[model samples]
Target: MAFTGRDKKWLKGPRAVALLAAGAAVVLGLATGGTVTQAAPAKPKPTHMQVQLLALNDFHGNLAPNPATSSSGNVNGTPAGGAEFLATKLEQLRAAAKAQGQETATVAAGDLIGASPLLSAAFHDEPTIEAMNEMGLDATSVGNHEFDEGYKELLRMQKGGCLDDGDGQNNQNSCPDPKSRFKGADFDYLSANVFYENTEKTLLAPYTVKKFKDGQKVAFIGMTLENTPNIVTKSGVEGLAFKDEVDTANALVPKLRKEGIEAIVVLLHEGGLPADPRAFNSCPGISGPITDIAKNLDPAIDTIISGHTHQAYNCSINDPAGKPRLVTSASSFGKIVTEVRLSIDLATKDVDRLNTLANNHIVTRDVPKDRQLTELITKYQKLVAPIESKVIGHITTPTVVRTADDAGESPLGNLIADAQLADTSTVTNGKTPVVAFMNPGGIRSDLVATGGAVTFGSAFTVQPFNNYLVSMDMTGTQIKALLEQQFSGVNQAANKVLQVAGITYTYNPAAAPGSKVVAGSIKIAGQPLVDGTTYRIVTNNFLSDGGDGFPAFTTATDKFFGGLDIDAFASYLSAHDPYTPGPTDRISITS
Candidate 1:
């Protein structure tokens, strides 16, 4: 059923201090006025319950300020992000909320562990989780990228595992103990709809209930995209299935309600926030999914924190009951923190009918760094310092990370795709790479041109994720099918075709929606591509698993080694020095 919107009850009542002390006393089996009982104080109806939810998403383990943007923007519009500065910001936010006499819960929308800078990736995501624990994050929803290493590795990261250092030793020299590979987090990981196929129950708990002062209880439900199986390595989630978000929430809410939890929030790894609402610049109508989800979700759901497509928007829409449901998403990369204050009535013990607030704070690094978080990050930072600061490759031209309206493809993306295709082709003994496609979303940052000198550090900053290269054999018709997926909707977001190497195609925007690619529109090495001919193509593991809805790559045969795709791109850049894009070298799409 289509989602229908409703009016929300805006916050309007006078500010009142929460009776958290009373709530705590009740939980502790103490008396406030009448009697001390063993019956949990009859749920101890709260007089007032105020909660502060601090959220961040897509922090791809950027422990240090990327040298690429050092010359320009800083975290808080200052210089750049250093652990010290970011720690300070997180701590300040938490402390300030506490000072205001409000309970706080720090959370994230995932993409925090995988594709991380060298420090965490090298150690198999431990460093990042440890850093997160230090930052006081309470819970997180899994992002697609979190499954980068597949499910077994994700489990290892969660329950701890072992690593080798090429010395054939049982453990890496740094971590002699197997248990040291992944130090588990202090917070919870929620995945409501994801489950083992046979059981049909959540692979993980659907949500976690957190208790606070004045007997106030809150529930958090987590969900990734329903098509997670399509975007994750088949082996990673071998026996798992991802159910629809709405269905998942509908099933779980009743369970939480039964547990005496009335206030509920959803931390979904999906997204809808756009960089510019009016401009619709890169991803137009990016908020579609999140908005639709919010409108249709049961009224029991009070708020939704989202991520994945890293645009930021702060607004509130209503549920089916005409009661306001607050929705907030902070800008990615630790650049912003979304703070939501949910006020509950002291008398009714329900969400305050007239006074709840949603605030999206831009986490500027301009503030003093938090010492506690800084110190914790430093322990890992020192161990990761050498690798994080190392130079791996260089770029001569700007590399052109993004493709504009009139533009056909991006050089940086082409370089990465070509590297993957070439790398796999050679390793497989001269297997011709007919085409290579790289999802635009995989290229995290733009290939920035720093007037004078350029280094590998800059390149790492541009392509930070650890997706690997996988080659598949597909017919030309399948390739066309893939292209169609990128341009399906008229007012779609991120519509640009995935950038490619070793092939080119023209798309007709004026044509009817489904018939965009005209006859003979696609080419391979300047020759018309025959629909029936089988061709070997190369794409990152992310797409091979159908990320961003590019399912064609998953249909390919003959997949190969699964090493980091970014490393391959870096190698290509290193091998080809003085890189430059000619007028028509990378891509050309005509009207």
Candidate 2:
């Protein structure tokens, strides 16, 4: 028997199928019907809202395109990155999101300025700060480089003020426009972990709560590595305390929840390395401090935007609750932007973590340039031309590059270390230096020599820190300990192998952590290093003060301050008129 109209209304949904199989004829309302009934499909109800987070990190103020042939200028074989192109790409991304009815926020993970090219650095990175404001950066974390000049200068970058030192302190100009002076960043600089010890308060705002049209709030908590003091100049973060990333973020979750906010984001300045280096969108075997930090983060945090390693990758890391969460980093220097589309649960006001998707888009130069950024770059170029155009020296074919080889040594890194050694050796900085060790991270860019002629601009771009030289005396044993640091301690997860001159050694990376260096393989000018022998070492003040986790450097004796690093580099280039690439044989890896 078939069911009648009234019977159909009493039937269940998909659950009705079970009733039908149980025996339909048992109670057919005492009448035979002509047809059987089927359930109509249920209409879908919206459960989430799309929010667009356009992120860029480690944009070390490349206001103009790097030299065409330089690695920094290219991304994945495409001529990419320049402030104009980056601005246009961001505009397109924001416009696309707007067309789709998505709420959008532009954010960065840090290193937005400092170590910039001549155009931006000449004005104390004010142009880059202006550019970031123009591009609409909503907020950013403070990277190690943000403290390059000192926390006071960083505050000035965020709060707008002219340097009291005026125009000539470090070959940089004061505010170009005296009338307007300098307008600080329109974006918020979140520094959750950086606090002034004496005051017991953050140096900047700890986090920013972004409120959208519907009143749904998203909290972005930002912080740099706890090891900041070890990486930045001691003078920069003198009274600031850097807290642990996970602990700091986790502590904020309860506070955010107290305010009924559930969707949370972290703009962390720490980063990781991907096993598959070439793929920006895929993170295979991603490992580093960020991984460990993500693993222990509070489950309430929905996303993590990381930087500092300057490598690109889109990844999904598991939170404390074992739920997959989105993690991303765009390669540095404004070369790429990681577009993250997060779905917020409308009912709960929390992120639908599973519904998130991220992509790292290259800032390809094919698109039309943003006029405003172009004008900014042009104005700065004109201001810096007089001094930047001065020819410093010449370089042979195949200019020295900063790209570290398999052994973690770069031709430019070697050149810089040698230059530092040469400077102190002749000038006699109280202690005559026999060895110079340069921190690889300090070698920012390639010394691109067009027509074999090196200009002050090109040289400055490679070493913009203006870090002065320090000559010190270290026992041979202390020197060995410093080399071991390349693969141990905070560096164990990611290497910071020093670039050296007047030294040769083979390291066995596969060996035990502290025993990577081969026995008796070390030599300084073809002589074995004696444990008790004292040797003079020259390095930039950053390294000499243990800036990169080499505590051994801090243990050295009789520090003698010398000229600026750039001065040594420029003078070396001039003295060596036609600088040639080294044999590049100083470092080696054991089989």
Candidate 3:
């Protein structure tokens, strides 16, 4: 739902304009004594409604730009993103639409909050919700990261209130704003497919209907990936059922049509991957789950705004009826915005499908920052400054990034795994961890350094889930089974190779999915793995409970819970003084 600043029907309509006394043109050629008179301009009545939807996705509370070294800091080699620039871009896009007599709504496909920078996540993302309000965001879908903190917290994000746990524990300083209370999202968070298992009620409103000036209506249905439960922590999605994305949206199409809303758009939080030569505005080739999902979608859906793959692509994948329907995604971290325009027939009350247009716009920083957003950011910067600027450690000149090599290992991933192992091995309460396994998905951002200095805030942004470390005992045979799960069963479609601190293994990427790991390639501490020997392994709770399609950890024994992963990382960084990116050679690849 794009937010039109005012009720568009009231702007310049016949009912709102004053009729001239003369009604038509007045002439100075009077019969006797003539007086010059001018007639008011005739207001042209618009024949149809032009609706513009300005959209963004996967913002992830990026109030500021990434460090120059971080890939997410910019787009297409140009400095882009940051809330100030994003707000300016949105305003510019909306203004352009308004000048054309088009109504506009700013929408998002979700990931607006959750794993955010310290400035936003420090106060439970209240600042982001406030920032969105100022940016005139009308609606967004509920993404998987929105559930990182649990559903109750997500409800709090929508309904607005003060969190009872504002004691500055676990990186949370909720409701620390001067107002002392959060007002929640001014925008709607549509959750069409997510529901409560008990009563079968949707977690949030299923869809939002936007009515235009000419009495035409459009519906925006939002949904996350159906496999959200498998990716998120169990407690976050506890008692909530995520139905198939296709079925949930299809069920709502007829419901909307019955109410005379034929122009439908889906703000789906799932997306596809663009093939080689991926450009921000056009797709050379497209494949992934979204390609199939879009094909199965009902023809009644006019447009689809997608995210979660964090890739930028604009395309028109065909609907079931074989007519091309617009499908678009703006890349993550507020770097891009998609402007979708549709011409709705005044007589038919539906979209002129052939006349629809869509494109992705990069939020370049050349424009002046929006004043309101600047003020909001400056205020939060002051509040978060103390914690954000505290130098906790130093890093090498070249930063350690989250980019993984062909063998599925990253320098940042290895660093985090080492930190976990270091944290667990020093504990006196349980057996020292023989290996530390980190699911690649948990490594959020890169370890970028400014002047070779890394701060607590930067670390928080890198690992913001605040997931606790859990250690469990398993035999070498069980460990082998766990490693196999990375490229088999649930992970075959999208494998997640674990980063390790105490082991090295080789695998054949082109081999059959279930047999990728080379025989006897796994080794722990330079020793060949023995099937009967027991070993202690450490990982975050999300992975231990099988998050990100890795479920083998569920059967381990003697689990030991430790402190926060962020703490371990920060401590490790400080203890090491000048941290360097790991060799990233823990995992090997065989042709």
Candidate 4:
């Protein structure tokens, strides 16, 4: 049905007619000398119901306010983000929708935990889950980060208790209270496309049906990108298989429709980037995998809420039947929340596509902090103070930032690569790694020294993934292939450049993808790399297992797992106090 600007007329039902007749009788009695009486008119049954969906995505557990310098934490150049502020905004939005006679549900597109800030990650992300439960999250799809600790650990997150293995190394089991236990998330975690290899069944509930008091039902189908295994650590998805997003979603649509659930919303963890960076609320020329997925979705699906790319945009995409459907995403780190309004037709039990609208609202820091969230943060902060405040080392200058250059090299990346190289230089097997590489995505933040001293929290924030350094042997030719892989195949669109140490190379960006690196340019300490010569290389486990589309590492031999990446970096900083930023001459790019 088409959305019109004209106000809908409310028709009186049988109950209202009966009430008016009763009132008329009273009026007649009053005219016949009986005392006059007044009766209130019966409230009319609404012909259609408005459902308000408050959606957020990629909230990587920033319970406390993020630093002002953090790009993701800012909204419209204002210091924003923090669970407290996010909670207040959600409450306000819910209240406003309620006032307008609309039912509201707060949902997320996932990445609610994993790779979180020091406060939440210190305790294995339990604090973040607890905070989300308090904020009244109704449901969320499983993002790739949810599989960071592996599927078993993900199950523990859903059905909670203390981590059975008790991560003694990182003190992940160090609860705020000695007797405290982590209570699982109160909301449902749906994963429609992920299936068990053994049983050939979905890993989690395919979808959840939300029923309103007025008999309006909407089905929420949740799933991550089908290529989850390629992005996450291989072990995390050992026994699981991710099916095609379009196929899985289309297959479920008929079942939901047969069950009388006409209104459907897909909570997808995969998202797209908007063409215009400034258009946070409007989708003008949006492009990415989400665009193709939305176009192929069944017409029965009403809206799609997505994440993973961590960009924001609200758009109306056409379904297979050429029907418009709302698709939206809120930027990462709880900085923005997308409010979607849907008008469901009572007779058809389907969304009135024309009447649907969505907008992204910033979670501004100007609002009052939520008291309960404040208390939660305070509790966790106090418990984490000792670890967070411990001095890790010192930085000689503030210029050592995480910002990558055109060639993908950065001072901080160089430092991390150096640290990994040093840590793997002398392993238990006595094999030394001659070169090291770090993924750009792993370097989460910059080493901004506060008064020249770097705190443990700062170090942890820089390398928050907790990936282990893996040393392996690869031929010089494979190493060159690895560099070329950065610009081709899966990396072509993402362009995930690798950070290097103990090696240097020059490349021409204008050259063909597989032939970007100049011949005879790859070198180690001024010596040209020989094609057949084998060399030991060190990198994080994520990359060693072919994560981030770096498949060249998967062919390496003589695997040796070393210390945690953060520890190696911290140790390097501690040993090299007053450390200066390294040169960014590792990778030279020529047009």
Q: Candidate 4 — which residues are off by over 4 angstroms?
A: 1-46, 164-169, 389-414, 421-455, 461-499, 505-522, 525-591
As a TM-score, model 1 comes out at 0.67
Q: What are the root-mean-square deviations of the candidates from the true structure over C-alphas?
A: 10.6, 13.3, 13.5, 12.6
Give the Cα-based TM-score of candidate 4 against the true structure: 0.72
Error of 3 at 480 (Å): 11
Q: Please report, in order, the local distance difference test score of every candidate based on alpha carbons.
A: 0.63, 0.80, 0.79, 0.79
Clashes of 2: 0
lDDT against true structure, model 1 = 0.63
Would you list the clashing residue pairs of candidate 3?
A: 2-105, 2-106, 3-105
**In model 1, how large is the Cα lDDT of residue 498?**
78
Question: How many backbone clashes can be found in candidate 1?
Answer: 13
Residues 264-373, model 4: lDDT tens digits: 99999999877665567555567789989988988888889999887877666667776556778999899988887777888888887655556677899899999999
lDDT of 4 at 353: 62
lDDT of 3 by residue, 1-591 (tens): 221323122111111111111123222112111222333432233555678898999898888877545567877688879999899999888887788788998899988986677788778888999999999998999998788778998998899988767455445677776566788988999999999996769999999988778677889999887877755556678899899999989988888989988889999999987763236655545677888898899989888899987888766666787666777889988988888777677887777655566657778889998899999889888888766767889998557898999989999999999999999422434478979999887788898788999988888878876666878888998898899899988889888899899998999989998778888999999999988999988898878877777777988877755656887998899999998775778899999
Candidate 2 global TM-score: 0.71
Native-to-model Cα distance after best TM-score fit, residue 48 in candidate 1, in Å: 2.5
After superposition of all CA atoms, the RMSD between model 1 and the true structure is 10.6
- Candidate 3 similarity to native, TM-score: 0.71
Comparison by TM-score, 1 against 2, better one: 2
